[model samples]
Target: MDNDRAFMLSHTFLLKSVKPFGEGLWQPGASGAPWRSDAAEPTADDCVCSIAIFTEEPGTIDLDGTSVSLSKGSAIQLRSGGRFSVQSGSGSATGRLAGWLVEFFVFRFGDSRPIAGGFPLLPYHQEIAVHPFAALCSVVDRITRTADGYDDPTALRKQAALLELLALLMENQQRSHMLDNAAAAVKRAISYVRDHYTEPLTVEQLASIAGVGRWQFSELFRRLTGKRPLDYINTIRLNRAKELLLLTDDPLREIAQSVGFRDEYYFNRKFSRMFGCAPKSFARSGKTAASRQPLLPAAKQARVRSSLTGEPSRLVVCGGILGDVLSLGVKPLGAELAVMGRQVVYRDKLAGILDVGIGGDADTIAALQPDLVLLEKEGVAASHFQSAAAPVVSFRRTEDVTVRLRAIAALLGAEREADEWIARHEDAASSMWNRLRSRIGTGETATVLVQIGVQLFVMGNRGLAATLYHPRGFSSSEGAAKLAEGSERFREITAEQLPGYDGDRLFLLFSGDERSKREARQLTETSAWQSLHAFRSGNIHMTEAKWNYDDSLTRGQLLPVLPHILSSRI
Candidate 1:
């Protein structure tokens, strides 16, 4: 790699926003309505990394053959050689889309040494913490202010800051380390791919499932699991193909296409490479037969059906956010209940009690007289629900969806319902995952900054803090977690404090009342916030105050909205 090329490659440019290069920067489309670039493909030498921040202006880009409308605060990093065009449309109803963009050159030393490929994006296996966006803006401001007289000292400072920013981005984008969390992400991704494989499964969509960036995710996945990202994806696709081959006796070409393979020959070759036999041979050998066993036995299946269609049934759901309770309760035959106070005991002999909050007192357990009680969170005890004459079911609140479901089902004498619910939800979640996988088959993944109340958290290996963005994806950021937690206060920091805060998109959460809205407005007005790319581009979202002290179902409420929020932002 040339020294300059290497230097560029070594330095990652964080883009907070992009606007046409012109004055009226604050005005949407002030540079001119977005238009397609008629220029031919430019050489690497002809391209330079340029980051710009802008308000949300309607804009379109022809990516490959598809036209993608760029939402406000949406950041894009382009290689010098890539050819693209942009056209502007009407601004968002809120007026201007706010955000900033920072462009840094990438130097490819040579084909043999890819700067990113050579470095492990995340060395640690923990959740990524969200860095304040203000810190990123400060770095960009400093660099731009001294651009005319770029001295050695300035260059050195810039280099160091850039490196720190990259480090932070990598840290925030690391996948959750916990096996269950990782498995959930994988399962969700698979579901998405299966559901929308007919569309496109870009790398960006997959990263959305894993809640990380395309590049960082690629590195992390490779480091943790010994397979390349695409290789792993193909493995999943092939497995599905094998299943189809055995189950339905679908034609080889149809099965290949159904699983995302465009060419039958290529699919067969790839299948042979991985499984040591052609698709036909594998199907004939009953390899796929082994994959088709009902996840549960006949008895279990019958039980599940009975539970779903049974008489006015009782559901003991535990360990979900308050929104989950509301969603579940509103459903027919769904009675939402929570154990209050501490020290609830389960006698195991009595029937379960579903306490539905009479006034604010869960003490009504004694008044209602039930068989079992379910408790969640800390500070609630078994003795509280003992008087209700029932067994108490208690479990830790985490991402262990199966364990949580099992506990709840046992209490309600609806173990079969729990199984069926899990099966159904898992199946639904899986289908969604497959659709996403197919959509962004291998596109670039964006870096995201999630803001909670006072602190910013990142997506790490534990996956505890990751939240799904609605319509299509998930994001790992401190802010996102904090929002999920429904925090009221947030840390106020300068842009300089957050280094890699540049290229990532920002998702802001706020309490619903007028006061929270006022605070959100105040935060947006701050110089630090304005400087950060997401704020300037209107990428910042004022999320509903779903998870407050009074409302404990934050996770439940946020999960469904996640995909929608993410899709809108994109």
Candidate 2:
């Protein structure tokens, strides 16, 4: 289809002047005014259009042979030569329909483009949303008020109002069309992922199928599915592997390869992290008892019984609580490091710690003969760690850093260290908030956005959110508050949702990954982002991606420097 002939009309039409022929408000019903003439009107040489807004109740209209149903706040247009009729209600029901109508022609200023040549096959019907519906109604009211004076001195103002109405209609149509296309494309991509999950896949390849940029594909995928593309793929692979572990006697390496994973060791680590138990252990207990009993070797079970003691000397950290454990002055034998290892806030303190990769390898952890194992509630299960022949203690990563710190301290017999860390953090936070009170409002709202890969998230009660949302400091925006109330640490959102979630102040969090930085820059350049109040007022701030981690070390580090970052912007 020609660009000018589609719902997204060309800019050339915008250059022409909108000249009104007639305008009126009418109701169609048993006793209401008639919309059509007694006889059918023939096509005219002049290119003209009739626009209508359904103000009350539902209605049906026939443009040529196509039937369109219009609900309240719906807008439609018809070309001069088209066969059209309007009636109240839909289908067999006869009811009342109230609306405003305007007939207009676009007069060319200088260019001689054929106005009648590009009328859309059938006019598009759009349902205006609450905000834009009011704007459209206000413009229509202006046109109605000025209809009588079209030939008088106020003609220019009336023409301008008509142009505004056209602009609003076009803008709404384009936005709605884009949103629909994006959603459909993402759905197609998801369907492809599920059908061909065993095949190798890449973001670029999936985006090609979706007909979108990789960055946009990533964001939309997360917004719609609540998981990153790779993560989702891994979930599929891991689930299939779990079923194989129960249904067959295949070796671990064969099972891993059959489910798209190339390395048996990598598969083992991910399996342990996701289900909290190794595949061998999960298989040993059978499907019925898997969750309840992750059996260990006889020797390891004996070792576990002997190690549940007053103080644990050797520790294996299997989750994010590594930071809290370190803060309490206890270093573990091994720890699961994040993918961005060099950027971790506590990287300097991990001098001799074994890098067990993310979610720690159960076999490697067990081989270390650790007396105790620390795991996160969301990560590798405590039973998995127990099967490693160590006393396992798990903490919810979403808990306040102080609470987690103290719990780790008590486990390690270092209560003094936990108290000192808490005291230091509290005093620093109080001092920072007090010093900047005059610079910031009493309850100035703030929102934190973090970019991971190409996905953007509204930080909830984790990471930088925990650091920023103190009673004496910045308050969470309405959108941020709602997200914090949920269990997820962050909520993925599209660019169009920025206005609703945006606050008085904005913080953009990005990781050291080049892709994440590029995504952040692209986000700031978008119209939705640039139009935000925080962006316009220069109240946007930056927090490194490392600081976005939900850990005691990151939270403690944010306390002192965050004041300077915000005060400088103010």
Candidate with top lDDT is 2
Tens-digit lDDT track for model 2 on 427-467?
56655664454346677899998877767788887887787
lDDT of 1 by residue, 250-329 (tens): 68888888788888898889999876678887666542221243323456545533543333232232333222323222
- lDDT at residue 309 of model 1 (Cα atoms): 36
The C-alpha TM-scores of every prediction are 0.37, 0.45
**Candidate 1, poorest ten consecutive residues by summed lDDT:** 341-350
| Model 1 TM-score relative to the real fold | 0.37
Instruction: Give the CA lDDT, 0 to 100, for residue 55 in model 2.
Output: 60
- 4: Cα error in model 2, Å: 83
Candidate 1: regions farther than 4 A off? 1-362, 410-465, 469-475, 478-503, 536-538, 547-570
Q: After superposition, how far is residue 459 of candidate 2 from its true place, in Å?
A: 1.0
